[model samples]
Target: MSGPNGSETMPLFEAVHDQIASDEDVAALDDWLRDNPDGQRQYLEFVDMQHEIERQIAGVFSRGPDSRTENATSKAAADGFLFPIHSVRWKVFAIAASLLAAVGIGWWGNSRLDDKPIAAIDLDASPVSRVLGIVTASENGLAYSGRRKLESGSALRSGRVDLQSGSMKIRMESGVELFLAGPSQIEMNDPLQVQLVSGTVTAEVPDSVIGFAVKVPGLNVVDLGTSFGVSLPANGQAKVHVFDGVVDAEVERSQQRVRLKDRQTVLFDGTSVAESSYDQDLFVQPGMNRDAIPTTTGDVRFLHTPPTSVRVGQFEHDLVLCFKERTESTLLETDLPVSLDAPGHYRVKPRWQNFGAVPRGTLVDSYFIHLDAIGPEKRTREGSITFNRPILGVVFSSSLLKGQNEIFGDPRTAYVTDRTNPKSDPTLENETITLSADRRTIRFSWRIRSRSDQVRVFVAADR
Candidate 1:
């Protein structure tokens, strides 16, 4: 289609839009665009329109888990317009795959090809902004920055967002994962830091990304490789709680910096900061959300493709499955058939691995990670799980796994098990069960040549 005499209809514009522009045509179009301010103005308007379309598309994908249930609208056309690539999914390998792979590099950043930016595409929570964080998980989540709402997978930039209601989790580009509770607003200062304007956010920082920080009114709490929580209540002072590892906290007004350890607390009031008693109930915990675990159906995977949902015999693709078994049980007198909660690395080895025994008075909850297989796709599969609370232990032995069929295992779940305890056979299933050093996550590799593979984890209860 052609435009009026010297606009989008120009041969040079057509060539660029068609992606057949020669070096000379590109140079000519650049020169013409520089001289024709009106032409530039008109194109800028379309870019802005495209920017809005991008936000609307993100809104479609961000509704958290609810998005899966909602029908997807017609995907926006990837015409020569600057289309951003958030990564595309290519299912199945075939001869026709190459024809369908119309992957476009960050079309949004095309205008910035040179040091000079043609026009800046600014939208609240747009992935185009300098990537600071990405929403990884949410529960009944509703967040807003100005008028734009943020859903799961929306990028957090160098702006403020008010999580008006519900809870959400963010994984910073620097690898710091934070859980934000609603009615709270936060300002990301940079890749390594954020300022809490209101509400509570708990961060789990790994060693590689040490020095990641969270700032509140008068305090700047920097993780020295730690997991910590910061809270700023409505019209209240800022409080910091270090759950594990260490944090160096500085009071802006007083110029005092203090290093805090596990279970320590710090309270800041814009002028003075002092050590305080730890409040265990100040932040989000397991069993607080609709699902006690409030998990993302998508498990974070490191090697191989992530698991997709399927039934017992439909092993068309790899699977990542997590189901809540015995939730919120204060099994004071009950002995778990099989489980381990100690923070360490342990493979699914029989007769050699250790399992933690909970004290008689401790409360407990259990979740089963089951992998069902048959036919050919019944080989090896990998997946992981992160508990909202600390884990007491994990049990995978067939005897221990089956013994709990009537206890922690869901009575309704048709769990497959051998009548006699089958010892761990490394050859049959080279399964591995490893918990992160912090005990917040468990990674496993399971192989099932028949009915199913099962692993059970017991996490601490909120009570």
Candidate 2:
């Protein structure tokens, strides 16, 4: 559900909305919480407020099966901020109600600090700023001169501070972090800054606009609020990655700027700007954007081919596919691998798209294939290609059900070809698929080796 306005994943606002709707009050409470702090501070406070609100509701009820015996006991618990409802069964129901009631309510009224419209930048502050602590506004200028070691939880605000030299842990105040190597200057305006100095830095901003900015000697690295690493090249060059969100890059010397998204990066070669790629560590978990996933029927076609080719000898010629998008967004990536019959001479011409059938946004998926057949001639070759598109009506279904004996413990049942059951209708499209005590239709796209055109395959499942 959307938050106060139409935010799909603003948990705090959703929670407050739900609470207000159910209780018929708390508009004042919600407004107070939101207007009191910045988005960063409000989010933190919301977490605490949610917990306390839960406690307060619990105190109104009697203790479990002892409702007849705990009138006084319950009243005492209500006196304090903590509710003492002791009825096990009632407590569960109360907790569930409380959670449901505040599903998407945040106290957003102002446009400056908290609950600012989604996908917006705080132009007042440094578009991206990182200060150690204590920003002293000097008569001459703003001096961020404190030499503080910004550890994991360390934070400070000032006009401008250059990270002269040192390994400091910097947080973006929104769960994002910036790791400065050394010898770098970080200037903080309200929402923008410059790496005017030099040095290497690594930053992780799962959400957009929650990390550091770059000010190359001849260029600028405006973060799209993603996780990535930046280094100064031999000349006055710089390299960056969009580990999660999009990062904007502008070539000061050339007056060029570009946005880099997850798994994407760009390089400034002292004279021009170029996009590049690198290997991501598997141990790191990326931050997520609640509203970024596409929820429509679409296609993901490769406007450009993947730079890295699949190694023919290491994996099976079959390529498995997967994707990363919001859960509410319907995704239909075939778990089955695409057959790559020819290796050395074979060119990948795969396409994924969102056909504008349902929602809109890019559907990002991973294609991984495992080859179990390898002969002297190499029975199977496997590799991967990544691509995205922001359209609709294209979904990938998993092949896990293939060769499986049963779904939901019922004897393996094949759906009848006739349309007696909706599951049997291949033409029917559904956004949700589940093999439970129910049934559903599955969509598949397939083509014969020599078929002149692609055929759409449909299967119905009976639970």
Candidate 3:
């Protein structure tokens, strides 16, 4: 294992092993071989043998998880001593012979190279159509229907909006207001996705809808759980505000996920999502025709103002919706049922439930939603609703309402079959227990076919 240059070839194997173990780039080997032509040939030969050993090891590891490649390498080194004709010196032969003499002569297996298949993250919202060249001061626009892709340079004014799938603020525009409802996807596809992108967008998302995803470069906002809005700086680079429900802010690069509650906002710049502990001023109010009573939760309140119908955008999974009116000029607020749950249990089944990790179990109930804005002229609403526990996925009895008096509740006994997907079968085994009368409440009861512990539920909403 010694080279003609007086350099040792066995040391080369150790170096390569270290690099591969550290996950370092393989290109570094070229730099090491630049000076020694003889060393380069030996390195190539060594690599060929190593690759073959790795291939064999991979098969063993795939079949038996306990097997490893290091044992194979040690075995190959031990076997090298038998050919003293290839040795560069007596010292080389002695070292090789010593390694071969060691006990446990059985060659060790190789590590597994099998890669797990990853599923695509479903982004249901559509792209923006005609986007503003630049939003400055106070300018407003509307998104009618379809998808709207965004450019990094688009700016949003306080009162301006690009309803359907536009960037910027989610709350009401400075003084100008826009609304997004139904179903759609809005994104801020900027490298620095930060700017004065501020505005108010009232979103009315119901469970019956589907496909509402908003992204601010580093953040992934998924809805279909409930309604909410996201406010950002007019500049693409800025913070995020959640007016209602919970917004699961996911960082793509790191795969980190965080949940934001109603009136809670977080800031992200590709690296992390930071939640604000301070109580920010409540923006927007309900219309006069409706009785708006703000929850006791800090500055967030609701007052009905003069009746005004805000426009909304449309999307593939559009559903019936009602908006919160500013009746008495109180703090702007939206209503969420107590028993609402997030879309986690049904969206992606647990890996353990996929047969590889755990046995198959019958699905009690499952459904997904898609919500988008009605038009460019409407305000933008983004965010979600999550339950404390996973439930037999929600079965909406009726669409959402604009006022408390019009709230939809299932106090009386009833059973509504899920029309969204035919696969879901609802039964008492997956019974859903709801708590309504103001505050958000979520609860579910189920009997396991076998022993099981806890389940995770996720909620995502935006306005």
Q: Candidate 3, after superposition: displacement of residue 16 in Å? A: 39
What is the Cα-based lDDT of residue 213 in candidate 3? Answer: 41
User: Please, what are the lDDT tens digits per residue for candidate 2 over residues 153-186?
Assistant: 1235543345544344443323334555455555
TM-score winner? 1
Q: Residue 59 lDDT in model 2?
A: 20
After superposition, candidate 3 runs with Cα above 4 Å error:
1-202, 277-288, 291-463
Q: Please, what is the TM-score per model?
A: 0.39, 0.29, 0.25
Model 2 ranges with Cα > 4 A deviation: 1-155, 159-166, 173-176, 206-212, 277-463
Regarding lDDT, does 1 or 3 come out ahead? 1
Predicted structure with the largest lDDT when compared to the true one: 1
The residue-by-residue lDDT of candidate 1 on 373-437, one tens digit each, is 43466545655677778877777666566666566665434554453234321121356767878
Model 2's TM-score against the true structure: 0.29
State which candidate, 1 or 2, has the greater TM-score: 1
lDDT of 3 by residue, 1-463 (tens): 3462345446546566545433342444455567878878877777777764543322111112112333543454465533211112222433433454565342222211111000010111222321212221111223421233222112222122345333222321111122432122232222111122334333433332222345555566654334555545445443555665655777877999887777676767658888754325322322222112111111111111111111111111111111222111121133233123332232222221221111123221111221222332222222232323233223322211111122221112112223322222212223233333221322332222211111211122121
Sliding window of 10 residues with minimal summed lDDT for model 2: 298-307
